[model samples]
Target: MNEQQNKKKWLRILGNIFFYGALLLLLFNPTAKGWFLRQLMEVGLFRPQIEQEAAMPKQPAVATAFAFRDATGTMRTTADLKGKVVFINFWATWCPPCIAEMPSLNDLYQQFRDDDRLVFLFINEDADVQKAKAFLQKKSYSLPLMTNTGQVPAQIFSGTLPTTLILDKDGNVVFRHEGLAKYNSASFVKQLKSLL
Candidate 1:
């Protein structure tokens, strides 16, 4: 009986250690944390509201002064994107939330990639451009990677890790969502089509 009790005690101890170890890994590891958050997103949490025309808030136009350098060394500005529906996402390589939502954002980009009226900008906030590029390549994501070339207007982005903004054809900021969101939802795609 004593031997059986000892065996049971060891099993309980092992289970506790495994549980605590995984908890610690989730807390300390950025990649693991991102994967966990992504699972939450897959389960239908943190979805952005793609409102219909009647429910859409009337947001005023913001100044179009943001400039960015693309991976191919081409300079693009909000001015260049005038008369088009622009989708801009500000993110960083080190941000777990940004990593968590990238797959959904990439899916959304793929859907509108061939549409000339719609533009997608995946702006990287990392100090190292090479690292950002490598991250995308490693993940097999073909997002239009861009880096800031000048001052970013505060109204468009205020240092949020995963800030998403949508501009109408007339350069108005029509939609803004901060933090992780599943952007490839059917409603979101329909809304973008309506804007186009």
Candidate 2:
């Protein structure tokens, strides 16, 4: 009877240690937090709030032009992508929310990467662009990284960590979502297809 009580006490102690260790990892480790958030997305918790067709802009409202440089050091502007549906996401290396949504973005990108009608600009807000690139490489994500070259218009970007903007073929902001969202949903794919 005494041995059974001792075993029970050890089991409780081990359980407490495991629980606390996981809690600490979630709180302090961005990767762990991102993984946890991604699990929430897998359960459809962070679904994007895309507007319906009626709510979409009847007349294409001209979106603000922003300049950025791609990983290849090629300078590009929003104006340059006027005839294509442009998908832009502003994210940083240190942001857990950005990390959480990256896998979904990658999935979405993979679906449309070879399409000439759409352009995806994953603008990294990290101070060290190399770190952002390294993170993407480590995660085996094929997202094209771009860095801000000049002041991004407030209308286009409000300095949000995980802000996403979708521009129609005419360079109009058709959809804008701020915060982590699962972008690989069938509804979102259909909306993008409709725009194309």
lDDT of 2 at 117: 97
**Predicted candidate 1 versus true structure: per-residue lDDT over 22-57, tens digit per residue:** 999989887888999999998999877656332555
RMSD per model, one decimal = 2.0, 2.1
Best candidate, lDDT-wise?
2
Candidates in order have lDDT scores of 0.85, 0.88
- Candidate 1 weakest lDDT stretch, 10 residues: 52-61
Query: Which residue pairs in model 1 clash with each other?
Result: none
**Candidate 2 lDDT, 1-196, residue by residue in tens:** 6999999999999999999999999999999999999999999897875565336653344446889999899998988898998999999989999999999999999999999999999999989998998999999999999999857888788888899988887887878878899999998888788888
Query: How many backbone clashes can be found in candidate 2?
Result: 0
Q: In model 2, what are the clashing residue pairs, if there are any?
A: none
TM-scores for every candidate against the unseen true structure: 0.92, 0.91
